[model samples]
Target: MTTAIDDPRRTGYAAEVVANTLLDLARAEGRQLTQMQVHKLVFIAHGFTLALLGRPLMYNTVHAWKNGPVVRRLWQHWGERGTRPIDAPLPVSAGEPDVGSDAEAMEVIRSVWNAYGGMDGVELSRLTHTRGSPWSQVYGQSADLIPNEITREYYTGLARSA
Candidate 1:
């Protein structure tokens, strides 16, 4: 009886899997992801994946939080680590399965990690908070779903220009 709705650990989506992968990447670099770092990186990963694959990397919602893009769920877990430097890293598994068949999404995540992982939290936040950025467009709104369209278009343009 492994119903999709009933399985809290596996939602048949790539979010947790991607989180695990990103955390592993963070660990390798001796970086402890702050809440902002976790959110921005995950959002960027989704943006690149949506740009390349026409689908979101994570099944979770991306919100234009006051700071920047945020995944509320992952935010909480990382938030618990507080604003202190060298906060404990989230577990690699974090109770979710690997992204079984979504290698393309993983590649995008890896690309994002490689390109942006070295950046500081403030820098990542600034990138996402840029004027005309999706987060800027919905900075204070309640229904802050970071638009898939904007994300795709922006990241696609970035990829092309890069």
Candidate 2:
């Protein structure tokens, strides 16, 4: 009875497997997920995996909140005790220790990336400014420095080729 739908090797069947599994789980738990919710879950799960694997975790904590259940489950199952909270809010400020120099700012970036599940440098810069951090203030004062790390050149090239 190996119909196309039953053939796990096929892309369509593989997708069906995942879809059925999710639907079955949702039905069993009496939970429903919208398309947007599912997209957010996939995005955050990818980000979390990248982070744990030492890849550049490029997403925002708001995205993390969208995937809170997955993060909570991962933490509970694998993460160390006290490493993170079961229901933690995203960090809004650079607490306590002052970032004094570029070196310090880089460290802040790393910590923010780790804590917030990563954000684009521009977004991170904006968030720091929003929180009234000294680094953000200094960066805001400087008109020369480009906030985005991805670089205008790369974007320009892509746009030109397109």
Candidate 3:
């Protein structure tokens, strides 16, 4: 049976794969991304995927952290680097789905990079923290998880307006 990762109808790559894909994209363009930047990029890519592709990008749950939307696992993976640029890719464990191989997901990721990759962490934070953003809605409330339904809805509206 095809699992979510192997299913073509979904793009539930592990957060590590998603982060590493973003890092790889940055590296190819001769730049390194900070931990915070990676967090924000992954979140943005996920949002866009939901909007454009009508599917989730990664299986990871995004939390409305104090700063912005964050995949807790991805945060911990590179959080120790603080504001410094992450110079290396996180190792993807065996049996994980490959981000590069997923054409649809890669298209979404590359588009996100083209549109938002140049923005720094603070700018990305501002984008995600804007009024009515998914993070903004759940930030001060008791809820932490930025539900996919909410995310999909918010981004769908953005897509329509754009």
Candidate 4:
């Protein structure tokens, strides 16, 4: 199986691009996202994409931060806890503003949202904080990027069992 690293469009998404879309998606669903929720959702969406599609939904790296997995670029936009609009080019390969129009991407995003959207930031944080989770494996490694392989494997197992 080809990994995102081997794909030409692996870098198709800018973190800001996904962050903006996710924030909008949350709002459209009447769920306003805090910085933490947005971060976890992105992580969850990425993991599902890797598990099911065998490709990254977005190009951004997930960082092991104090709370959980985070996209640094998204954090920069949201600040410490505030959710606000940050301009970014859409993630579509064609550079359109409708990044959510990609059916496969939307399917994963909505699936993740439905599974987690009702939860608070702290609950999502706990989910990532599980002892064997990718974030747990790198908890104190300040500069580590949570490996995609770990997330893919973990979520794949989850998908299979569910």
Tell me, by lDDT, which candidate is best: 3
TM-score of 1: 0.79
lDDT of 4 at 37: 74
Going through the candidates in the order shown, the clash numbers are 0, 0, 0, 0
* Model 3 C-alpha lDDT per residue in residues 9-57, reported as the tens digit of each score: 4758889999999999998899989988999999988998998988899
Which ranges in model 3 have alpha carbons more than 4 Å from their true place?
Answer: 1-11
Looking at model 2, report the run of 10 residues with the lowest lDDT sum.
Answer: 9-18
The per-residue C-alpha lDDT of model 2 at residue 35 equals 32
TM-scores across all candidates? 0.79, 0.24, 0.93, 0.80
The pairs that clash in candidate 1 are: none
lDDT of 2 by residue, 2-40 (tens): 575433222111111222233334445455433333222
After superposing candidate 2 on the true structure, give the runs of residues whose Cα lies further than 4 Å from its correct spot. Answer: 1-24, 54-162
TM-score winner:
3
CA lDDT of every candidate: 0.73, 0.30, 0.88, 0.74
- For residues 45-80, could you state the per-residue lDDT of candidate 4 as single tens digits? 888888998877777788898888988777665566
Q: Which residue pairs show backbone clashes in model 4? A: none
Candidate 4, position 80, lDDT: 69
**Cα lDDT for residue 47, model 4?**
86
